[model samples]
Target: MTAIAIDHDKPDLTGDTETQNDIFLQVFNSGDGALFDRLYRDDAISNFSGEPLTGEARRKFFVEFIGAKPVLEARVTHSYVAGDVALIGVDFSVKGTGPDGQPFTIEGKCTDVLRRVEDGRWLMAVDRPVAAGGLLPE
Candidate 1:
């Protein structure tokens, strides 16, 4: 099966984290990890599972994450942009089947750091999943 490839600026938000996050939801719901691969830089880091993800590992994790076919929605609660960098706080809900085919849904918050490219496109630089007050334990 061929996965869909989402544009990096699909939603095309003008430095708006809320709409960008909504676009993330749309990309996630599309069940396409390709979009994630494109949204993150080669050196981008994510701590969604406590451990850091970078280089090929980040891509691996995203492949597995998206491969799970999760249905997710995100609402940005806070956003700050200065120059070429931005920080966003989001509350999100995700429902999906586990590896054992068990159904699961997680509602949590996250903090994401994004950087604007030379062409004025935003991509994730650091994405840390926030739950239970702070970063997910390692």
Candidate 2:
């Protein structure tokens, strides 16, 4: 288990997972789903619970998600690398307005998997957020 302390005042968007996490926060808060083009791979999958989402389904989800424009704060608990694939655990909290314009907040952990591409860049491959536990896949 590794602990990461993120300084909200000065977030450095230079590294791998850290940069993406910040991007995640930014896109959500700003309701800019277009930014997803840079943060995720074309075949990327995201799971809130159960099986991951991909393809057109994923795109539609992002549209709905961005419309909510949730504010988020995520902290990395642990990260592991193996060749091109990396598994990262993040603890996160989110607050936002609902369809009714009521503010709400939720806190939990997420497991995000990233892969290093041939271009020497890292992109999210799988994202499982707000799960009950920060458990990594076997």
Q: Number of the top candidate by TM-score?
A: 1
Candidate 1, superposed: residue stretches over 4 Å from native: 1-14, 132-135
Model 1 Cα RMSD, 1 decimal? 4.4
Encode model 2's per-residue lDDT on 1-138: one tens digit a residue. 233333343322234766667666765566655455345677988774245778777767776766667777888898888888888898888777878988867677888888877666677788877633332242
In the range 1-138, model 1's lDDT, one tens digit per residue, is 233344554423237776677667767777767666667766888886568888888777778888788988777889999998899999877788988989977778888898887667777889877665444773
Worst 10 residues of 1 by lDDT: 4-13
Question: How high a TM-score does candidate 1 get?
Answer: 0.83
Scanning candidate 2 in windows of ten residues, the lowest lDDT window is 5-14
Q: In model 2, where do residues sit more than 4 Å from their true spots? A: 1-15, 49-51, 132-138
